[model samples]
Target: MTTSSTQQQTSDAFGYKWARRDSYESPAVRDASRAWLLSRYCGGDAAVLDAWLAGGPKTILDAGCGAGFSALLLFGERLRDHDYVGVDISSAVEVAAQRFAEAEIPARFMRADIATVDLPPASVDLLFSEGVLHHTDNPATTLRHLAGLLRDGGRALFYVYAKKSVVREFTDDHIRQQLMPLSDAEAWAALEPLTKLGIALGALEGTIDVPEDIPLLGIPKGSYPLQRFFYWHVCKAFYRADFSVDEMNHINFDWFRPANCHRQTPEEVRAWCTAAGLEVETLRVEEAGMTVVARRVSAGATYV
Candidate 1:
């Protein structure tokens, strides 16, 4: 949608900016939150992370790390040897650092815009980014920079929003355009209609079944993750959608984000990878987004 603000900051798809907020995250919200945390380095998609992490003994850079969720999940209890550096433009950097301290993990966080974050060339073994690049000033340029940070034979795991889901599309558009820019109080007021609708629809109790007509692409069937999906759309999308200390501060930062890119097609991503000189290893579609693992190699270079 069209946003009119003195300053527009980069935002995740649908402007669902992730940060610390006091609003107690609902159960479904918490599950979604945990899922996102699990999606960082080894992300929720283990296949992509595992493949990229094949040949190891290297450190990882959690590019666009929002809350250190992914970093902790990836190198948490099982694999704690690999060092991790988490970076985000938001002040969550401090929160993330604290989380690492509590977890006793060799992790650190910095508040730096990934696009302009000046990292040494070819210094990292793996670059893990999820739902971050698209929200940057220039997504393609961001990807190029992230790729540059990878050492030779190093792999990158990226999870970008894919333009294949209808429900998700509706949810984001409704929030960004019809009801964004409202103060949390005002936004919460505006959300009454949605919450009511969800309750009514859910109250249907399978009375009026949704006809098997237009397929809701990407979104799985059978009440799969329905509670979380509803909360995200009805409440979280409108109010502060995070659960952490000093949340309003984080919410305000998210409110000012300008650049908000979104889902792309496989053809689009594949073309970009080829043009960037990265070899695509795996490409898959998920309910909410897509996963791509590509390796940046020199001309005439190959890998096993």
Candidate 2:
């Protein structure tokens, strides 16, 4: 598919996903997500995040904000303290606007591609793009464009998927390709079996000890839970006992329905940051992805 078509498909998939907000908006899920976000961005200290938000950043940009969930999870009432702008490539921005309106929060929402959105350069003080860059046509180029909108010394916090085992990577691509032609509803229905499989695998309480590292497949030597071993080395069957079946399916659909879900290595991510004139402050790498906190160092810098 062409880049534009791929992005459009991705946008449509996410729009459908976000519209079913109630599927994943339970209190338990919100708390868990908030804790994870804090751990990654604020060193597990809510005070750190609070202080940063109160640190005189007058304007905040939520790039690729899907239904404003991340912003709501991160900022809460503190969002009212700044001029918040949410830009998304899909219709989810409408949901975001309605949500903020109902919450009595003042904000602006725009439906536009973050990579080429018309926003004044150096007008933003804080930019947040959670799990978004990887879904773009070119993550590095997109980052460069978003970073250019930040003033010198402004901060950006974003996340991207990390490269997984060779088998898992291939399986992910294969699944996504198969779902590309299906409507969003059909794709969601198709993922139910995978979610059930994840539950079944998760129920088998056992661990496997790999005798040694299998570098060829990226399987490290260690004891892994049965479900996790397959999840990390084979295909993604996201399982969390706390989440409902639909919630689990929501995650699976999120992973498999998008056409532009790119995964990258830590080295590549760091290079993208450097090329975007961003100075990395903290970069946390996990089996799933990388979370980054960076500050803009040069407003006019371009990707090399």
Candidate 3:
């Protein structure tokens, strides 16, 4: 896996942002709560959850293990005796080490790019990556490399941003370009209006009835509960009663800071899996993106 100068720069930027993460554990969150959140993070895809709960994996790779939250939830206080490896291309690996150590989950954290990260081929049983690949310079290439790490029967779950309307595509790129050049502080300042827009929309209670799509705004025609719609459409960084202000800010920062963010269509993702010799097991597409659970297949098995 070769890294380009551009990819290195983007990795460096993410490293800085995640290094100063607000809180490793949310307020009053326990082992159970963390697990619950992880489940929700998977978009409540039952097949994926069921496979995870079946619990036969001996080695797990948290590929983009941001701050080790997913690793902690997966192995710390529940699954035991598994070799859990968390790798990231940032100082967030240090934060993950601290958090996992506190949780008594014996795990390894490495500051390495997922595309180039080293582990024996076909040595992993489960690979869990969420919200990571799309941030890379070439998501298809990265996904293929990661897939090679899994054993023939091994499985991986990937969460990637989905392609939205043309209007949304232009707006997102425009905002990111403006913010990418600014310092972290300055970028956060620039995102204040967008953040507030999200909050203001989230504050509206009750459901909205829509009869047709608003193409110009990239809003689809649907009956959206006010809060849910605000979250999915207006902005994803809205303040929540369950999250800290810093957490909200982190979400906003995550969106605008990254220099390489590529949204993919389902057809493209399917093509990737097929080329990588993977068979899709579970797939759930939400407003933000799609959550896919695929297993490596080397034989005559079909992939869809």
Candidate 4:
């Protein structure tokens, strides 16, 4: 298939998947619930977010902002003060709108591909695209496009999956190919075994000592926490005990359903930042792969 055609297919698939965000994320039903308030700050350190927002009222763009979950985390109750724009390529934008409205957050959601989305040049103060670019047909090019949206000296953060062990990589590819032909319901049904396996492995609370290095796959021989190793090598990284069965299924579907999920090496991610003239503030290889925070070198310079 052509590149544009592939991009459209990926977007449509995400559109379908994210419309069921409540199934996965369980967005708050009412304004008073603890889930409602806590969901706003889920999965991130508040102090780090505060540091990012310290500059005050800047134009923030959440590229691939799925269901406004990140927006809730980023803006919280102070939404009226920040200029936040969320662009996505799915019906999830509508879901995001509803969720934000429920929270009384004055955030806007637009349905558009982040790669081709048009905005004023050098207009964004902070651009956040997590777990989004790697699903695009061309991650490097899409990343450059995202970088172009930032004002020179503006900050941006991204998360992409890290390259995995060769065994795991092939297993993921095989499972994804099998799942691709199945309907969402069928695919979820098919993934139950894997999820159960993950649950079983998580129960084995012990450490794994990798006595020999697998140089071919770049897996260093070391003492790895068993839970982390199980997640890193088996079960599609679905070891979170707190997630409900449906939520775990959602994670499984997210991994196997996407048509274009790319994993990159640390060197490649660093190279992209360098090519875009973004000075790296931090680059961490966490469970999600690589999380990078970078700033454009100049205050208003174009990235072309």
Candidate 5:
């Protein structure tokens, strides 16, 4: 498929996903997600995140801000203190605007492609793009463009999916290809069984022992939960007991429906940051993806 069409489809998928705001806006999910975000970006310290937010970043850019969920989760009421701009290519920006309005938060919402969005150079102090870089046509180029909008010494926080084990990678691609032809509603319905399977597997609450590492498939010798072993090595059937079935399905659809879900390695992500003139300060790798906190530095600056 052409890049434009792929982007449009991806945008539509997210638009549909975000429109069902209740699926993600529940208090339980928000609390859990906030904790996860703190762990990733603030070293698991709410105070640290608070201090950083209050540390005089006048203009904040939430690139690819889906329904402004992450921004609300991260900034909360502090959103009123800064010039917050939320940009997205999908219609979800409308939802985001409505949400912020309902919450009495002041923010500028723009429905524009972040990759080529026109913003004054060096105008933003903080750029937050969570799980969004990889969805762009060219992640590296998009990163460079977004980084260019940051002032020197400005910070950027983002996340991108990590390349998984061999079998999991194959399964992910296969599922995505199968869903590509379906309408949004059909694709969402199609994933219910997969979500149910995850629920079933998770209910077992069992464990498995890998006596030997299979380097070819990236399976290491260790003790893993039954569901996680399959989740990490075979196919992604996300299972979190705390999340509802629809929420779980939402997560799966987010993974499978997007035509632009790109996965990257740590080295590649670090290289992209360096090439974009951003010095990597923190790089956290998990089974799912990579979370990064970087600072914009002088062009051609040596990386340590």
Candidate 6:
């Protein structure tokens, strides 16, 4: 596809057709949500929760809550009366509501945009988001909105994309522009060439040994097909998918079919904190991007 067509195609996919948004809500997805919850809150994510627990917050907000998978982290545990609220923009809340109620875990959830959802200012004690912000039209603005919802001295943890991370970003754009415009079945079929190409790239000796190294250009590994392997691996990094003949098909469908996705960097994140009037308490940039804990300066901190 021409670059212009690709751009136009992706924009169309990102278009907020309310019904389409509603339709995408409960599509059969592999259990990435379960693995994601483990890796985030208790695995790598536990560090985030530990920080808040250390800070002794009494309330928490899981912005962009999606299916409320992370809420499972605190199941059956004493929360010091800290209430965790998970919010998402999709009707996935209905399914999540049933699951949580069945599991005997009660959490408050609402359907709203994380960017402008209204809540009591200075009411929340902590905010947590993972791989959620960049999908919005304005991540920085979203940060400002969420930050305003926190109580003084309350902290927020965020994970977002990084600069110079080219592999998936390239393939993501390529698939959305070149591939997502096709019907679901057509898009699924179009992935064959990309799959063959990705297998070929996966065969490269040691090219992918480092997280930052992507044979991104001017090589057999640089083709759109090869990039598909990169996407699969990056995805598997966060999700434990059941390996099946149809697994690649499923990954391709999710990666390409998603109407919108975005990635950001540590520096850009810090800038967003500054621009949003937040004082970052901590920020660690790893190979993927950044893990940040920031607070609104007006909110005073209290450990006691």
lDDT of 5 by residue, 110-170 (tens): 9899999899999998999999999988899999999999988888999999999899999
Candidates in order, TM-scores: namely 0.69, 0.95, 0.84, 0.85, 0.96, 0.67
Give the CA lDDT, 0 to 100, for residue 154 in model 3.
83
Q: Tens digit of lDDT per residue, candidate 2, span 156-217?
A: 99999999998999999999888888999999999999999999999999899999999998
Q: Which ten residues in a row have the lowest lDDT in candidate 6?
A: 236-245
User: Candidate 4 — which residues are off by over 4 angstroms?
Assistant: 1-3, 26-45, 205-207, 224-227, 235-237, 299-304
Question: Mind sharing the TM-score for model 1?
Answer: 0.69
For every candidate in turn, the CA RMSD to the true structure comes to 6.3, 3.0, 3.5, 4.6, 2.2, 7.2
Cα deviation in Å at residue 147, candidate 5? Answer: 0.4
User: Cα deviation in Å at residue 207, candidate 4?
Assistant: 4.1
Compute the lDDT of residue 257 as modeled in candidate 1: 29
- Over the full model, what C-alpha lDDT does candidate 2 score relative to the true structure? 0.90
Question: Candidate 2 at residue 130, lDDT?
Answer: 98
Per-residue lDDT of candidate 4, residues 119-188 (tens digit): 8878998888868889887888887888888887788888788888876788888998888777766777
In model 2, the worst 10-residue window by lDDT is 295-304
Stronger candidate by lDDT (1 vs 3): 3
lDDT score, candidate 4, position 213: 91
Judge candidate 1 against the unseen true structure and give its global Cα lDDT, from 0 to 1. 0.59
C-alpha lDDT of candidate 3 relative to the true structure: 0.73
TM-score between model 6 and native: 0.67
lDDT of 3 by residue, 107-150 (tens): 87788889878888998888888789998878898889999999
What lDDT would each prediction earn against the true structure?
A: 0.59, 0.90, 0.73, 0.75, 0.91, 0.58
Candidate 1 per-residue C-alpha lDDT over 1-304 given as tens digits, one digit per residue, 9 for 90 to 100: 2322311434231223344323323454556555664554334665655555556556788888776665565545533666677888765666667767777777756677777677798898878886676676667777887788888777777878666456655655556555446653455455555544544444343322223444545433434233444533233332332333233323323322233656678788887677666788777766446677778788887787
Over 61-177, each residue of candidate 6 has an lDDT whose tens digit, in order, gives 888765554455433353434687877666655555665677676678887778777798888887888666865667888898998898777777777766434454565676677
Better of 2 and 3 by lDDT: 2
